[model samples]
Target: MKQYSRVTNGYTVVDDVTTRPMVRGHNFPAYSFAANFKYLYLIFATDTPRYDYATGYLSTEGKILRGLKPAR
Candidate 1:
């Protein structure tokens, strides 16, 4: 695997591939095994498992980041 990094607007950014997924979104057995198992809550209110840092608030994959906040 490869790695990358850059500085943007004073923030250091890196690739999401630097990490591994410990838990998967579609893992039913794992969800069944959580200590706080609540069936309705799990089905209706669970957050999608996060495998990366992308939150749609900004983009960090190019020469410059998109959707950056303006400096005051």
Candidate 2:
């Protein structure tokens, strides 16, 4: 699987791996927001008024693995 993550250094970094940001950018096709939890919140910026862009949430167990779904 193709995974994504960032180095553990920043102003809004959380101790948990999943809660920290996965990526970032400036314009369309940019990753503006990400979250790590039992459920992950990944929002892609399409720069339009259509349902506020595509999103994905991954539900996982602690330090192991769980489930996933694709963005729409």
Candidate 3:
């Protein structure tokens, strides 16, 4: 298993080893109409092997977004 450190503006991150991707998006509303709220939009962009492997449940994909907060 590999470890990583990421910084976000005002969101929260949780780790799930039993799960394949390891990280996922939660609390993000599907539709909105604000630019600043754009940060609330969670997007995952992975490459071929990386994407396949991540989707295949091998490696993990780092989470990226706005409104993220550190773990307590």
Candidate 4:
């Protein structure tokens, strides 16, 4: 598993995996169940107005984020 964040670009990255050890000396039945895993990433950006008078002006901004859920 690995995780990293870049402040300069306001972006985040994550990598991960889930695995189960094979049953030892067992052949009657073989199966594996999900252990529940999730991942998320986010990025942000901002801009400033060019005019000083716009400082008090109301502004709207937007953001984007990604989310992942474990397989059922």
Candidate 5:
């Protein structure tokens, strides 16, 4: 989500809804994940009989992370 504000100076200020790290500790389920200049792809063992496995993406800075189902 993005938010904008108007000021008398004829300029608009913009802000976006984003999430940062929650717990202050070293994370990333495993050590050997795939990465490049911008993003990373990793598998998270869901450990659930139904889900089985899942996918995750993280920015290089590890700030923007999200989860999704792997493509069949």
Candidate 6:
């Protein structure tokens, strides 16, 4: 496992090996959003149109819009 330090001096860095980001971008596929929301829900409306777009390396193709309700 890779680790990093949280603090650094003028010309030195202490390898604490405990301070690290909770979420790693490489853990998820490219061009996708990964997040954790306590009250958000994935809304699926058959009658409503889904929004997806891509430009360069950014995209929302495989992701769905999350909201407070299941249908919107």
TM-score leader: 3
lDDT of each: 0.32, 0.33, 0.35, 0.24, 0.34, 0.29
Stretches of candidate 2 exceeding 4 Å from the true structure: 1-3, 8-23, 26-35, 40-72
TM-score of 6: 0.15
Colliding residue pairs in candidate 2: 18-36, 19-36
User: Against the true structure, what is every candidate's RMSD?
Assistant: 18.9, 14.0, 17.2, 17.6, 15.0, 13.0
Task: List model 5 lDDT by residue over 1-72, tens digit each.
Answer: 012232443323233324342222223323223232223222343353533223444555543354755569
Estimated TM-score per prediction? 0.14, 0.15, 0.17, 0.16, 0.17, 0.15
15-70 per-residue lDDT for model 6 (tens digits): 34354543322232323223211112233332333432221121135344444333
Q: Which candidate comes out best when scored by lDDT?
A: 3
Q: Write the per-residue lDDT of candidate 2 for residues 1-72, one digit (tens) a residue.
A: 024334334223223455544444223212224223322322342354532223432323313222434549
Ranking by lDDT: 3, 5, 2, 1, 6, 4
Residue clash pairs of candidate 4: none
Q: Cα miss at 67, model 2 (Å)?
A: 27
Q: Mind sharing the TM-score for model 5?
A: 0.17
Runs off by more than 4 Å, candidate 5: 1-53, 67-72
Which sequence of candidate numbers ranks them by TM-score, best first? 3, 5, 4, 6, 2, 1
- Which residue pairs clash in candidate 3? 10-67, 10-68, 11-67, 11-68, 11-69
Q: How accurate is candidate 3 locally (lDDT)?
A: 0.35
Clashing pairs in 6: none
